[model samples]
Target: MPGRTGARHAVVRPPAAGRTAAPVAAGLVLVLLVLVVVRLPWVGDLGMHAATVQRLRHSPLDPGNPLVDADTPSPYYSPWMLLLGTVARVTDLPVFAVLRLAAAAGLALLVTGVWRYVKTLSAHRAAPALALLSLLLLWGTTPFLWSGFPGLHSLALTVSYPSTFTLGLAFHFWAWLTRAVRGAAGWGVWLGLGALWAVILLCHQFSGVVATAGAVATVLAARPRRTAWLRPVAGLSAGAVVLWAWPYYDFFALFGAGDGLEPVHRVLYGHPVARFGLVLLGVAALVPRWRRDRRDPLVVFFALGVLVVGAGWLSGHYSWGRALPAAVVPAQLAVALEAVGAGRRRLRAGWAALLTGALLLGGWAQAGTLGYVVPRGALPQALEDRYRPPWTGYHWITPWVRYGDVVLAEGRPARQIPAYGPYTVAPGYPDFFLPDEERRTKATGTYFAERTPESVRRGIEREYGVRWVVDRTGALDGTGLRAVARGPDGQVLYAVP
Candidate 1:
């Protein structure tokens, strides 16, 4: 029953005259909830993840592989999909609605955690509230928004990404770890830490890397004597081995053998110098506090965030770069909020104005995102119809697709049909773990575009075991496929027979 010892001295106390924290926190939650309501069934990864949940609901015992067109065994350790799928089954709710609800829940948790974590960093009432506002709205202005940057994809992908779910959970774990390391926690805290990491690892392997590393850094900072290291290191390693080892071992060889990176269009907003300048500004801002708060556990946490991004850029891994926001943003907010809470009257005012402006900009950016029909761009007429009520693009073709049937479809159709239906989509989204994913994806373009000869068609069908084709735009010229279904949007589903 050692309550948070030194809790009062943990951070600078808030000024006596500041506004109440509850209303601001509730407002932030409302904003996120509104977003979830407006943007239902988000396209891209969200849609795909929803598709996976839907599949799991029907075949809870054997969900098979939701990623591909065939029942190729899934190598992913996706506890998130299983959790949502189980909920969908029990509640009898539509998969898309489940996805939206999950998003709202995640955002709520994230805001609440932010509010709590900020209190540990600084006691300024506005610091926690302002930090929440800044992060949710001003995210687009960060370097992470750069086109091709990992941050853009990570945040934009929303609920579909297992990493996205980890955002709030990780922070709460962080708060608990800080308390536990300080000897304020009991045996239950230790158990909770281990259990949390296990869930994180099972949810996403990449998140495990960041979370485990962060946890280790936290333990090192706390420097707790007598078996302190044992619990964190042992717990994290065990979870990694149990959840991560199997999928990685199964897929690592294939991942390494896979082809090189394909080019993607970059979306650069500010000049390159602007990004660097922001980093410089952050470092400069931290310099004053370094002498005073250098040994602070949260300081180490912030350094780890910078290290993750720097290493990501040097190692040529986009995942690390994209994930920087999730791992680092909280730390960034903490740094700023602490500065605001601990600074003088004039200094605090300047910081507050900057944060407020950032929040406004962030809100504008979010508006733009919500206005878009799809995450990447405007959805095609075919895809637009797919999201509508009663029946959709996937509905038209799914009935004809049998289990284990490999169907050839273009990228849009490929991503959608297999997600909501029982069939596997041919040449679907590129999975780094799937060895031939890149090769198959490239060939898909050629197969759909060219006047493929019967010889080529037969060879492809023979090689990939393709039996049906969803021709969205009359892309099947030389491939002799018989039309079995015509879609509302001029889409044709062809059977090889």
Candidate 2:
């Protein structure tokens, strides 16, 4: 807040032509994203999210383990998903259709939130539009695809995820918190902010971390009077109450269950140069801002993100890598701000040129995302080579598998089968809260073992109420199971006799 006016005091407005072109470019990028969402390609965790919606639609109050047939609490039962579930139940729309609606809403919130937050930093008309583009396309040439990171390719794949919605709300939260701290906001406003903070956390825990870091950075940069401290404390207390009262899952308990996630998240630390080299441009922008004001919000925010992520790597809690956005966003915003705010015209032009080059390279690197909206064959050879095909899904098994029926499957099939309303014997993803996760996983392996006795396989099926078995063809031929159907990639659905 100290630098609210100081940071933009020497600002120089962009040219009229630039003012017109920035928004046009931003709008076109958004339209491309809309097409990607409309297509809803099956990639990453699509099956998991689809299954989560499927379960919630049938039993909103007690939608158990999303991937397995167990009465366990799931962190995925966020307020947003619950709302989507309600909409699905009322309209009887397919789960994927509801997800598309969710994607559109999340995208709108994200774009508007970015606009509002950028306005708080600078008054320039083109700043917001430039910030939007930088946030999406200023990453390194490498295609880093993840749920929380908003690199063009990643956002295209995870447009419908709860992480996207949560992150969008995070931007709004930071903007509002910055204003509240700078002004004389009443206790009621602070309390509402606190509750909103908790809701964001419940919606997506990883993004919640990013939001909390930004909130902390905002308050620190504001340098509020000692007497004003009570307001933030009060807000935090209110948020704690909401987290405790939420009945769907034990949000606090997740703190102790991160060990199981280290293996998967370790990858986030890999390929640092290819994934984040472009951020150095923003780092350069931040040096001047930091010199002008030690407590500059973007500088402080980037430091906090780096500290958290570095600690995660050193401490082996790689799940903390999700907070990478905290660092990346500030840097991205710095580049956008410097492009228009530099006092010297030459400096501004140089920054603008650098930014434009980075955007072009980033965009081309992520061009493969077009495969989601257009046919791969129609794409140029270079683009096609970069394109990764999406999952074909397990719709072929849906005719033989009924809703709520358990299926004994492993690997990719296990991941996708539940999207159609059936549960797998073991979860394809990590399940920290599920009490019987290890047992269920072991049972799935035992059932599919080539040397396991037929009697043992039957017992395992009876134990879990598995009505169908999906595996490679001929894997269960001699087990007295009847073949139900054959699916893509040589997978066969067999009935458990």
Candidate 3:
């Protein structure tokens, strides 16, 4: 894509116009790698996303259900994921390996994006370095990696849920910097639309509302030379078509619809307090400087983006993944704008130091959380959703299901779990008549609170060929059920004799 090439050309230019200062930019990227050290954010949503992409290799064009269909189940992401999926299907890349690759790609995109935009304005060989450095610093933070990590692993629309958000912001910033660099009198609505449309679709159809507001905000806040709609409309259409054609969206929603299962998109992904602070800082930084760039529309565009995100959350469910790109993209751009405009060398240097410190501190704090106590608290399910241990998913799962435990048992991800690999939990409900592959293979029986349906109890009895049951204990409640372990959450045991 021209986007990638453009950034490279700009950064690798001849040293004539204060150009050869790539070291600083490289340094920035190195420092921001704190998250990698902590292993805070797994690239590619880590396992599940890689699992889905790998599953689709055998069967493509699935229209049934994204989550249920192993071929293309990742609904939260866009279709671009299939590119990797194809590789998985053909070459047999392990899910984790694919995730690492995706993560690396995402890093490359973000770096290139920041470099090009910053290069447009920076001179003295240090400008691109400074801008690149700032972004690197931001990425360096643990929280930032956690927040942005999804962009790599999630397939289009699915992963783009967050990537688009980030990409949208990056797009807007790029447009702003392009205008500033090109020395054009006005911003181009057309260039901005290229990413905006994709962002809207990526965020979900509702994000269109946010996109609309951003258009108005840019017009109101930033002065642009041309207001032509044709070019923008055309670009937007193309991007949208690309997104629509991807199979990730096609299968997940249609075939897999159910009452209880929730897509990760429905829930907010960031800590409320933490995200709120980020929001406030963005506003504080941008608003105060708006008057200075009153003629520049990025400020107003940012304001509108913020409002829509907050409002979107209040009116409907809020996903931090959806709102973050809008906030961080502008916030970082504004920082660059301020530093670039500082005029005095000393002031620019000082501001740069302070900003770098803040970002690094944030990154440090983010990484620190993962050190010891956080993992127990931060499992995606612990803070954000309810999660049950995988059926037949304990350490001892190896004891029963030989080929594999009941895990890798079902779903689009399950098929890829190596045949008979009980590693992944097989489904439980919706068919009490049939045992979840894991439990069946492991000879494990289901026991739950009052919620356990009679049919399920009967199914348990039938499948295990036992009498008597222990609903109170975690173990098989069959006639052989026996007491083993007990806790406030529940009890443990075997089938009672």
Q: Which model scores highest in TM-score? A: 2
Give me the overall lDDT of model 2. Answer: 0.89
Global fold similarity of model 2 (TM-score): 0.97
Which pairs of residues clash in candidate 2, taking residues 3 or more apart in a chain or in different chains? Answer: none
Write candidate 2's Cα lDDT for 187-303 as tens digits.
Answer: 999999999999999999999999999999999999988999999999999999999998899999999988999999999999988998898899899999899899999999999
Candidate 3, residues 1-497: lDDT per residue as tens digits?
11132222222223343334435545644444423323324322333443345445544555222222122233544444556567666777754455556545555555565565555433324555555544433432223333432221122212222343444345444545355333433335444555555554553433444344444554444334464434545555665665566545542243333223224445554555543343334355566466655744447666666675666566554443355445544565566545444345675556555565655554443433322223445654423232112122122322332332223222323333332222233332221122233444343323333455656655655544433222333333443345443323352323333
Q: Pairing residues by index, what is the TM-score of model 1?
A: 0.78
What is the alpha-carbon lDDT of model 3 when measured against the actual structure? 0.42
Among the numbered candidates, top lDDT falls to 2
Off by over 4 Å in 1: 1-29, 60-62, 69-75, 142-157, 184-188, 244-284, 370-405, 425-427, 432-439, 442-446, 462-467, 477-480, 484-491
TM-score for each prediction? 0.78, 0.97, 0.59
List the candidate 3 regions with Cα displacement exceeding 4 Å.
1-45, 63-77, 121-129, 132-227, 243-284, 295-297, 313-316, 345-350, 369-447, 450-455, 458-473, 477-497
| Candidate 1 lDDT, 320-365, residue by residue in tens | 5434553345444654564455547677667555655544544543
Task: Give the poorly placed runs of model 2, Cα more than 4 Å off.
Answer: 1-11
Please report, as a residue range, the 10-residue window in candidate 2 with the lowest summed lDDT. Answer: 1-10
lDDT of 3 at 232: 45
How high a TM-score does candidate 3 get?
A: 0.59
